[model samples]
Target: MKFSTNELLPLVSRLDQLLRTAEIGDYPGAFNGLQIENQGVVSRIVAAVDACEAVILQAAREPGTLLLVHHGLFWSGAQPIKGILYRKLKAALDGDLALYSSHLPLDLHPSLGNNVLLAKSLGLTGLKPSLELKGQSVGVMGKIKPMKREKFEALLCKSVGGRVHLAPGGPETIASVLVVTGGAGGEVARAADLKVDAFVTGEGPHWSFTAAEELGLNLFYGGHYATEVFGVKALARWLSEGTGLPWSFLDHPSGL
Candidate 1:
């Protein structure tokens, strides 16, 4: 089914509504909206985790690809279209693609959102909003019945469809795990302060591993794109259900 840009805007607006209801993001990342317009009409939709240079190149292949992403372009200062930046811009413009992005807005959605999905996958119960970030509660921190760290990592791997990179710390049996999807490893210090049994997120810097060891906290690195793919896929399913739009998820993997 084809939808004009105007027709699809409502469907897209519903997506934003769901995200607003779901997200728990703080103010660190900004400008989570339609970053670019390529075509007046949108026929095929592509949902991915990031709007990076490589993903941009991939989207360029489809003429008028309406790329929906968890991470939007131009989050930082605007730079001149030169070098790699030039390539990314040129590809999107040349493809006549429109880019729509939702960051923290996508993470905390109740149903069909990253945090909720992840939490449910791990059998987390009584999940409710706990922490706030960037004037918005973008992350979900809740209680879960104690489980083994290995079992928790296995669930993460199965849910995200990736190999688990686990830095096992603390006890074999964990009572509560703190989960922040999509590169929230930098929050390790905060998780440590909370003294959770295990902390799970996507990607980690050099220091995070050390800190996890020092603090005796279990750490799971489940690839950034892999972990975040849940939200967009859920959003796409939601759009399909709500608007009857034939949406497709562009299964792109970033082995980061």
Candidate 2:
């Protein structure tokens, strides 16, 4: 099956009010939708967590493919088209591969978002939105079956498919956990204020270490790259279902 590359715009527009890419202040580099344009047609979709050089090079092998990613090509923002960045652009241009990104948008989407999937993976019940930013809740908070912190951390590690960083500050028995996937360790203090027993995120600053201990909130760091893969996979799958176009995920873990 194939779809016009333009079709994705209308399909994803329904999510504008929900993802709020325009309103949410993400890293200036996360330019969101359609970072690169293709030759107006897409027969295959490749979803990945980042648009790193390796992923770009790989996608270039499959000409005219559309690559859907979370992290995009502008971390350094715009620069003279030279060096490695030049190579990435040249590869996409050569391959006719389009790149589309969704950062906070992917994180907060209700049906196919990162936070919701992670929360569901942990068997959280009565999940409610939390960690509001830019007038949107990008995370979920909810009750987990009461259990030891060690056990809950183990479950989280399984859910994220990576080893987890646990700062044991709260009680041994976890009553609730709040999930904000990817670089949200700093939110532990806020999670503490909400009376949750545990907080889960990808990575955080070193200062967050002190905050978690001081606030007595169980902090779990489930590698930033690992936690965020959920959204891209979910999104590409949805597009496949809707368009009948084959979709694949290019897994390249940063191991951060």
Candidate 3:
């Protein structure tokens, strides 16, 4: 099956509105839209957390594929398009791949976002948006039935499908949790201000452990790559269900 690239315009417009891509403030390098165009047609959709060279090359295996990702190319800012960068672009162009990226926009999306999906997976209730970044609430705070901190950690570990680093700074029992997936560990202080019993995030700076302890906040560090995979997968599934386009996820873990 194939779809004209023009057929993607409506889908892209719907995504832009659904994610509020234009309204949301993100890193200048996010470039949160269609970063590259295909040869005016789409054959399949590929979703991944990052648009690294390996994933791009994998997408290139199928010509006319739409590569959807959370982290786009060019996070490090402009540089001479040579070496790995050059190879990546060449592969995409050669394979007629279209690349679309959504960083903060996808992270904060209410129903289909990384934070919300993870929160739901953890069986959280009373979820509300929290943790402002760039003038938008990029995380979720919610209630979990009080449980022993160790049990809570185990549940989180299962949900994220990896080992979790815990700074057990809060009480023995945990009832409330604030979740901001992917590298938001620096927001420990802000989460502390929210007075939630625990904060769950991807990786953070080294000092975040001490800060969590001092601030009386339990911290769970699920791997950054693990926690962030939800949004892209959810988005791809959504697009497939809506548009009847086949989609696949490219798993490239950066075990950070």
Best candidate (score: lDDT): 3
Residue 108 lDDT in candidate 1 = 70
Q: What number of backbone clashes does candidate 2 have, counting pairs of residues 3 or more apart or in separate chains?
A: 0
Instruction: List model 2 lDDT by residue over 1-256, tens digit each.
Output: 3333435455455335546767777765557777887776677888999999999999879876889898887765667889988999999999988888889888988779999998998999998889877677879999987998888988988998879888888899998889999998877777889888999999999988779989998889999999999999998887787677789989999898
lDDT tens digits, residues 1-256, model 3?
2223336566677678878989998876658888888776666888999999999999999887889999888676677889988999999999888898999999999888999999999999999999887788989999999999999999999998888999988888999999999999998999999999999999999999999999999999998999999999998888777667899999999988
- Residue 191's lDDT in candidate 1: 78
TM-scores of the models, in the given order?
0.85, 0.92, 0.95
What alpha-carbon RMSD in Å does predicted model 3 have with respect to the real structure?
2.2
**Model 3 spans with C-alpha error above 4 angstroms:** 1-6
lDDT of 1 by residue, 1-256 (tens): 3323344466556656656633444344366767777656666677888788888887778775678888876766666778877777788899888888887777877787687788777777777664556665555666677777777777778877879787786779877777788887777777777767777788888788887888888888888877788888777766665545567777768787
- Spell out the clash pairs found in candidate 1: 22-108, 22-109, 24-137, 24-138, 24-139, 25-137, 25-138, 26-133, 26-134, 27-134
In terms of lDDT, the poorest run of 10 residues in model 2 is 1-10
The CA lDDT of each predicted structure is 0.74, 0.84, 0.89
Worst 10 residues of 3 by lDDT: 1-10
Q: lDDT for model 2, please.
A: 0.84
RMSD of every candidate to native, in Å, equals: 3.2, 2.4, 2.2
Predicted structure with the largest TM-score when compared to the true one: 3
RMSD, candidate 2, Å:
2.4
Where model 2 places Cα greater than 4 Å from the true spot, the runs are 1-20, 75-77
